[model samples]
Target: MPSSSGQCTCLRPFLLGSLLMLGFLLLLFTYINPNMDSPSLGMYFRPAPSCSHWANQDNSTLESDNETHHTTVLIWKWPFQYKFDSDCGVFGVQKCYLTDDRSIYNKADGVFFHHLDIHLGDLPKIPRPCFQKWVWTNMESPDNVPRKPWLDDLFNLTCNYRLDANIPVPYGYLVPRNSEDPDFQLPTKDQLVCWIVSNWNRNLLRVQYYNRLKDHLQISSYGKAFGKPLSEEDNKKVVSSCKFYLAFENSVHKDYITEKLFRPMSLGSVPVVLGPPRDSYLRHIPGDSFIHVNDFASPKELADRLHHLSKNPEEYMRYFRWTKESKMTISWFGKEHACRTCGYIQKHRKSIEVLDSTASSQPPHGLLTASSRPPHGLLTASSRPPHGLLTASSRPPHGLLTASSRPPHGALKS
Candidate 1:
C-alpha cells in the first residue's frame, strides 16, 4: 500500500503541473485574441500578399518557338457577355491569352472579376495557387455601385476610369490624328443647338441644368424625352447638322467624362458639356474645345455666349481646330478591358501573386470575358496624356488592379 501511494503521489504533481501549464497557455491565447466570435477579425488584418514576398518562379509561361512568355488571364465573369475578338489583338497585346474556361483556373496566371457580377455567394471555389492574381474591376460611379465590404484585400488589382486605378481605362481620350487628310471635313451646319437623350433621369444635375439652359437658348431636342427617338444613323446626321450638341452627362464625377462629349465632337458639333468641372475636361481636350456650363454664372450667360459664337463664324470655326491636330479614341468596352487585363498580367509577371483571402470566403465560381468604356476632344485637345490616362505606376506595385463603372453608372447617359 505504501509503494502504490508513493507512485500515485509522484504522478499527482506531474499531472497537476501539466494541467497548470495547459491552463496558462489557454489564458495567454485568450489574452492575445479576446473576441472569439468574429473569425473575420483575424482575416481583416492578414497582410495582403506583397510582390517581394513572392519569389520569382516559372509560373504560367507558355513556351513557343520565339520563346515569348504567354500569360493566361481567365475572366471569371463576362460583364454583360460583350466578348469581342478572342485575344488582346486590338490593344496590340501579344503573348497573353484571355479565356473563360473555369477548368483552366488551376493553370491561369490571373483571374479578372467585374464588380457587378461578384456575389459573395459565388466566389472562386478552387484552391488558390501562389502565383495567380485576382483583379477587381468596376466601371460605374459610386452613385451606381454601393460599396461591397468584401472588396477589401480580396483582390490583387483594380481596373477602371479613376486615374488612381492600377490600370486606368477612360471612356475615350484625345490622340494625334492626321487633320491634313482630305477625307476629313467638318459637316455643314444648319441648326443652332441640339441635344439627344435616351435615358432620362430627373435626379441628374444635367437634367436640371438643361431645364434652365433651354429657357434662355433656342435648343432642338431629340430622343425619348422629346418623343423623337432617332435611329443611331439619323442621330449622327442631326448632330452633324447642328452647330452645337449638348453633350451633357448623367453624373458629375472625377474622370467620368464619356461619349456625351466625344460623339458630338466626332460629328463636327461643339459639345456644350455638363459633367465634371471645366478643368477636368481641359485635362483631356484643349481649353477652347467645348463650352462648359459651369463657367457661366447663369444659363442666360451660356445662352448669350452660344448666340455670339454662332454669329461669329471665325470663332465658331476655331472649335473644330483640334481636328487638325488630334482625334478621339473610344474603345468598345468589353474586349479592350479584357485585353488590357491580359496585357497587364503579362507585363507585370514578376509581381503576380494570388491573395491569401480567407478560405471561408470561397464560393462556387466560374470564368468569363466582356467589354464597355470610352474617350474625348477639341479643335485639338491640348497636351493630354495620349489616352487621358497614366499607365500602372513605375513602382513594382504589389499587384495591378483596374476599375470601370457598370450599369448603375452611365457611360454618358444623363
Candidate 2:
C-alpha cells in the first residue's frame, strides 16, 4: 500500500524508540542494583548467591582494612567441625562459609584446631599471616596431651573450652526460680557425697586422692570411669540428689578447672573442688560457694568437713548462695562452638597477631597462669570490652575480655 522508502521510514522510528526505552531501563537497573554486572539483567532474574558461593566471594574480596566485615573460619583439623548452617550469624559475625579443605586455609580469617587432634604430620606447612588467626583450643590441660614441642608456639588465641578456660565455655542452665528470687523456697537435697568418675586410673594423682577420700567416707560412684553407665538425665538426677559432689580434676594445674566443678555447681551440689589454688578458683566462683581440697591438709580432713555440712542443712545451703545470680550449664559444642570461634575472630583478628614464640620466651599476655593474676594481666584489657560472668547477656557482643578467656594455650590437659 506504500512505497518502499515510506515503509522504511515508518519502521525506523519504532525500532529506534524501542532501543531507547530498553537502554533507559538498563541504566536505571544498573544504578539501583549494584550487583547487576552483566548488561543483561541476569542478576535480577537469577537467585541470590548460596552460602558457599558467598563465602568464596568474601574470600576473594577480603580487604586488609575491612577485617570486621568478613566472617569465615576454617576448621584446620578433624574431631571438631563447623556444624552451623551457612546463614546463621552468632554474636554479629555471619557464617559466610566453612570448609575442611586446608588448601583454602588462607581464605579464612581464623583457623581452629582441637589440640588433642593436632599432630606434626597433619599440620599446615604455610605460615599464617597476621590477619589470619590460629586458635589454640582443647578441653584438656598440657599434662594430658602427649609432648609436642612444636605446638607450644602455634596460636594467636587460646580457648580453654572446658569450664575454666580463658573463654570459659562453661555449661549453662536455666536459673532456678527459688535461687534467683529470695522469697521462693529452696529445695532440700537428699543424698550424701557422690563421684561420677569415668577414668579409673587415668590420673594417678586423682586416683590416689579419690581412693584416700573414699577411705574416710562413703562416696557413691557412677559412670564408666567408676560404677556404670548412666543416661544424661539419670546422671543429672544423681548429681542433683547429692548434697556434695567431688568436682576433682584429673590433674592439678593452674586454672585447669573442668566440668567437674561446673556440673556440681549447676546441680545444687556443694563441689569439693580439688584443682588449682583456692584464690584462682575465687576468680571464677564465689569464694563461699565450694570447699577446696587444698583448704584441708588431707582428704580425711575434707571428709570430716563434708560430714559436718551434711548434718547441718542450714550450713549446707550456703553453697547454693551464688546460684541466685549466676547459673551454670554445659559448654557449647558443634555449631554453637563454631559460632563462638568465628565471632571471636571477627572481633579480634585485627588486633591479635600470631607469634610462634618458643616455650622459653615470654608467652602472650592474658594467657598467663595464676602466678601472674595478682599483678600482670593479659596484654592489657585496654583493647577489649569489660568482661562478665560467661553468660550470652553478660559478654559484650563485639569483643571478649582478653584476660578472662586467653589462658595459656600450652598447659596441662587434665
TM-score of each: 0.70, 0.65
Q: Please report how far candidate 1 places residue 298 from its true position, in Å.
A: 0.7
Candidate 1 residue spans exceeding 4 A from truth: 1-54, 57-67, 178-183, 352-414
Question: In model 1, what lDDT does residue 114 have?
Answer: 78
Q: List per-prediction Cα lDDT, in the order shown.
A: 0.64, 0.57
lDDT of 2 by residue, 1-414 (tens): 789999999999999999999999999987877544334423112222333453344432434323424456677764433233543354334534555657555456667777667777877766554355666666555566554546644655655544433244432333323332434234466778888866667446777888889899988888877548786678878888888888877776656677678767766788888877898677667889889888888888998999998889788778777756655544444344455666655444344423232121122222432222111111211242222235545332332121112223313222
Candidate 1 RMSD computed on C-alpha atoms after optimal superposition onto the true structure: 16.0
Model 2 CA deviation exceeding 4 Å by range: 1-68, 80-98, 101-103, 125-130, 161-188, 334-337, 357-414
The number of the candidate with the highest lDDT is: 1
